[model samples]
Target: MEPLDWNKHYDLANLPKFDMTLCWNCKAPATKVCSGCKETRYCTSECQKAHWKKHKAHCKMFGQMHMMGELPKIMKKNEPKYKGPSMGRCSGCNVRFTPNYPPNDKCPECGYTACESCVVHEVRGTCHCTNHNFGRTYCIMEPRWYHKNGKTGEPYIGDRHPEDPLHEYTPDMYEPVERQCNNCKKITKVFKKEYWNPQRFNTSWF
Candidate 1:
């Protein structure tokens, strides 16, 4: 049997220069190649100079990996190992379900997932999902939904889903506030629940 090429299975192993040819800086079609690595591409000299500060470490590491001839092995090693079952498990209830089962509610930020029942029960009316009993947990909701108010400079709820618990409340009246977690007694940022979108709830509850 022929030896398997692990590089074919790894994403990072396929550098953008070989595929898309996008400039590492401006993301434009790049023709000029990095003299040192010959792998990184740049659209212009200025873009290359500007990106050097950030790309320097990566270029150096790439050179080392290339010289060692272990890039494929390294890429394979770094590939994420998903420990979750093929049938997804709920982050809250830890229930396993078939692949065809209704989609689980997933955290936009961290990609944490929980079944519909556990999500509703744990989140309550607040837009926070309880994971571990840690101090001052981060809000799992999409951060873009919160924006700074013009006058106050405080973060306030922006556009809300149709079924949001506080959808009727305008952004001017209510501001995003901090609340203490009941289990850990730690101050955490909480928002009004957006029921329709990601938080799938039973229809009869309405």
Candidate 2:
């Protein structure tokens, strides 16, 4: 059998630049590449030794790939953008499933989609609105819906009057306020300032 040309498999462009890459052990600029893998770089032998336990499995895998005459294929093919009606890997646990598995919740901040199991068990929390006379405790998960000012698009913290069906609330009266976590009862204080306003109002609950 012809020997496999492993040299062709190494994608050097995909490897992180050695000068900019930091040592896994010390977070310092790496000065030397691992002799076995030629991938992970370290500043000193001490850092390499300190990182050995964590690097051993990766080292072995690289060694196996080298022996197999396969250049490291680290660049993954870009996955097609997810449309509705299909399943994908859960960002939380890295498990891939089909529609049999429940729908995933996408994070507004990072755009990571986690499975329903993770959302329910790991993400769901109770938030308390102290402005309410009874102090309303409500269950909240990722992608929370909030009432934002129509003109400024900034979220307002004031409670809407129950009898005011027309929603006659003024912007000045909607001052920002601290809200508590109903489960832990921890208060998070924020300045009454608008950082980035949402362009569109959230109509999911409406």
Candidate 3:
């Protein structure tokens, strides 16, 4: 999708010049444009093939886009909204739950309904044991949320198990704990907060 403020760009939009003297696949300018995409000009088919290794993924799906002048879909941001409940029903063939009992199916009956495409999970609790797994893990508390926005860059209260992908946020997962340095032969770890404030290692002023 277009960036947030795309309407403002309509007047300023500039189509790239498909300069047909260089390689179109690489945008290096092409001696001949491919009759297929017409957007690329390759010095030789060999140049196109060499570039294909990196370009194939985008090439197949992008072929029609290049010719038809349409942009690809943009990815949604990662973090989920922390709303209270399902306001509507599930689009994924969900049935309504009776008021007496909680909806105990793949889909839920209450809280704000999301576009099925947008919904990651129907249940609200963090820690993956959504449906009362015997372990019944604790809800990853917000304070512990990724070590309070620690440098690890894991989301707050991500899934707890180190094996779980979100485990990266758990302070204990990566531990930032001491490790034997392969180079120095001394124990090493991430610099402590005393020495590593974001302003020093992060924001800068020239």
Candidate 4:
């Protein structure tokens, strides 16, 4: 048996227990080697300048991590929340902003936040024995299809067996709406229901 490299196993750890190769100013990988005297490192143009004071004495020592001829493989946060526009300095006063979400990021928590459309597009999965993409869904609160009937033998419906519910709407939801975008162009849409009820009954009893 051998001691394992924690960095390799815990590279994505969120808590501050481990030190990541982050630019002193911003919490990003210091992958870009400094060109000035070729003895410093930073993640962006701004960090390069911000870290100069600290990195000046280390010119003869290790400067920064060279990009291994590869753009770091970043896992995209699906439907990442759009926290408006952000502009700020890093812990070392280096300014930068990412297009995704704000800077106070952790792995698992950040992975779940999403924007409106991506939040509503809906998702599904397949059974191991027979792969299928059943759209009609159910949840204890909303997903209407796959809910547990609470009857003798109904399985919990449209739940996470496939994936968490996305678009939430039961069958009887046919309706339309009109709106205008920032350009003032008219738009209309009908958020149709997921499943069509086959247990039809007469509507004339009113």
Candidate 5:
């Protein structure tokens, strides 16, 4: 039987890049890229083998993106202007910090940190360690439909700072909260103020 493809199964989108040219296990200059995913690089086979346990999940994810023709898009590095704070790095993924969109997830062990896809429980849970918190600092709030201009009452559509104001939206509005699904009637933890759209519920709550 074939292994599960979570991207397809979960309708996942906006995958991350594994295209760094340095050794994934150590930050040495590398010439060898993982044959399996053609994304991660390693200085030697030893480094590849050493990193396999941790890289396994990311390797599989990148390989899946390749099979689905999504690899090119991820590897392109078309990042938008930085909208988040100047957090140095993510102790979890070791990548530079980026925006957490909204309802940012703060690492339980340390305060006000965000990680790659911190919104996901499985990913978020592994973000803290003995030495330091793997999550970065919360920088900005992503615009949401519920955020209305104070005077115009129109939906605000831009990155928001903590001090910024929209009469209808609060910084904590997207923080995870429990809500009852209108369609299934099952209570689930959702980003606060998020609406349920049955068709897109599996992928997002906008």
Candidate 6:
């Protein structure tokens, strides 16, 4: 997604006060609310620029609302809701299923149903998750092995072992698995001891 041009929507007098008191940019006391969205705040221009990448989508939506002169109405409509399960295909695997499927959970923002496997994969960083707000999906990085003698202090280029053709490597040999978030598409390094949660974590996603 592209960054929003906030300069086009800078009208402080027309902007509303954000419900939160803290700045979304620096978590400091905010003195200004984003004139474009009126939903985000920043302590200064530098902070706003730093947070623009994460806030652009919401900012653009609000800008659209301002253009239509329906900011209030649209904000109310976009409010989060507890949407019980509805019949639909899994957002992750695109498999069709009923609401009663044991592995389904509906998105509160978009009413999209994600199957258990897909949700597991998302949280575990094995695959991508659908973003209802953006009408698109984000993906996690794939796992890779590093070479022993290749360039040091630089990106790793995979090295082949003599047994590559005769033996299979298992992930169990590694300590802490590296996974990525589907929402932010950022890598998360997790240790088995600290991140393991039987209720929410599933190895099947790997």
Judged by TM-score relative to the true structure, which candidate is superior, 4 or 6? 6
Who is ahead in lDDT, 1 or 6? 1
Best by TM-score, which number? 5
So what's the TM-score on candidate 1?
0.25
In angstroms, how far off is 32's CA in candidate 3? 2.4
lDDT of 2 by residue, 51-164 (tens): 888787667656764555543343233545433222377655667867788545653322445576755542221111222211222222112233332123343343232223
TM-score of each: 0.25, 0.24, 0.22, 0.19, 0.27, 0.23
C-alpha RMSD of candidate 2: 16.6
Kindly provide the TM-score of model 2 when superposed on the true structure, using C-alpha atoms: 0.24
Q: What is the lDDT of residue 93 in candidate 6?
A: 63
**Candidate 3, 162: how far from true, in Å?**
97
Ranking by lDDT: 1, 6, 5, 2, 3, 4
Model 4 per-residue lDDT tens digits across residues 75-177: 2335456332223422112234346634342112112222323223232111111111122223222233323221122444221211226544433453344
Instruction: Give the higher-lDDT candidate: 3 or 6.
Output: 6
**Candidate 4: how many backbone clashes?**
10
Across residues 62-175, which tens digit of lDDT does each residue of candidate 6 receive?
Answer: 766565677578788998763433456665566777656754555444455567776545332122212221132221112222111111222222111112353443454324
Output candidate 6 Cα RMSD. Answer: 17.7
Q: Report how far off residue 24 is in candidate 4 (Å).
A: 3.5
TM-score of decoy 6: 0.23
Candidate 5, residues 148-182: lDDT per residue as tens digits? 32123343332222223643443454445555533
lDDT of 5 at 56: 81
> What's the lDDT of the predicted structure labeled candidate 3?
0.37
Where does candidate 1 clash, by residue pair?
none
Residue-wise C-alpha lDDT for candidate 1, range 6-46, written one tens digit per residue: 34544556543444388878888998988776667899999
The residue pairs found clashing in candidate 5 are: 114-136
Model 5 scores worst on lDDT over the 10 consecutive residues at 130-139
How many Å off is the CA of 90 in candidate 6?
65
Candidate 4 stretches greater than 4 Å from native: 1-21, 36-40, 63-206
